[model samples]
Target: MNVLKRDMQLLKNSNDVVLARQKVRQWATELKFSLVDQTKLVTAASELARNALDHGKGGEMTMELLVNGSKSGLRLIFEDQGPGIADIQQALKDGFTTGNGMGLGLGGSKRLVNEFSIESEVGKGTKITVIRWK
Candidate 1:
């Protein structure tokens, strides 16, 4: 895979989450993604960004324009250095949440993208990567 472009943003507060969504939308638009695709990516970005800020205690988001074979895609990586998730499987299950949410962030974000992955250490942190191909 070749990364055509890359950018990073700090997820420090709610404003940063909005900014992250805007940035994702801009990138998706630049890639000529459809309106529905743009909305899906932006929504996923918002959920992951909020998770980074609220559950991970503020983190960073990296956006990448990727080219693999003849396909182009947008990739998002969210990382945070806070108490990590203990049970990834349970977390990925719908209606499972440690916070006071409707419990659809992680699972819903996964459905919005073409690829999704997550890594976490109990006492270290968590990292989530998602990709949407166009």
Candidate 2:
């Protein structure tokens, strides 16, 4: 398996987001990810991509897809440059959303994947990782 990464500029417009997801889907298919795995991964990517635009106020985001050395599965890293998460714990609690939000996005996206983890700093940014097996 090979690893690939791309930088995304956060934009609220849906068309911009569609383009971003297309790039991710292309690379994911090139990696030969199984159909089921690809579906979940692509959905998760779309969610994160939208979050970057809607929540992060348009910032720089990095997307990385890797096939772990163990050869078991793929891991994806979606990182953004913004004011970072304010309340990490509250944010993870299902149905808790702050600002122009309908909630159920992140937590739901997390549940759709196998492994999910997040890191954030007050004034820095947020980095979220999700993985799915073959």
Candidate 3:
């Protein structure tokens, strides 16, 4: 999938998020992601996808699943071209969700993976990448 895709105005609801997550899980499993790590990757991808949908309004998301062929690790890249984030530090803080959730989305996702990175620009968009090792 090249980790890059575009969807039309999918932020209109939350159900889309569920579907997207499921798809990511299925794909990860097929890609040889360990059951345990698959869950983490899928969960993180889901949360971030929802974040992109919820926050970006509507934009394309790029995802990447990297395999070192030795189970060294896998990476997921998600990018959205919507409104950019201003305070990266504040957003990364625990319980910092701007939405109705507990704000643990980012924090929890961070704990699930070994490496996490997010970059955003005001009036631009946001990009999040998570890496997990086997």
TM-score of each: 0.98, 0.75, 0.77
What order do you get sorting by lDDT, best first? 1, 3, 2
lDDT per residue (tens digit) for residues 4-122 in model 1: 99999999999999999999999999999999999999999999999999999999999999999999999999999999999999999999999999999999999999999999999
Give the Å shift of residue 114 in candidate 1.
0.5
lDDT of 3: 0.72
Please report the TM-score between candidate 1 and the true structure: 0.98
Pairs with steric clashes in candidate 1 = none
Candidate 3, residues 3-87, lDDT tens digits: the string is 2232222434577667667766766676677788888887887788788888887544444555555554556666677788889
Candidate 2 structure quality by residue, lDDT tens digits, 27-77 = 668778777767877788788778766666554434556556766455656
Query: Which residue runs does candidate 1 get wrong by more than 4 Å?
Result: none
Give the winner by TM-score: 1
Query: Could you tell me which residue pairs clash in candidate 3?
Result: 3-63
List the candidate 2 regions with Cα displacement exceeding 4 Å: 1-13, 69-73
Stretches of model 3 off by over 4 angstroms after superposition:
1-15
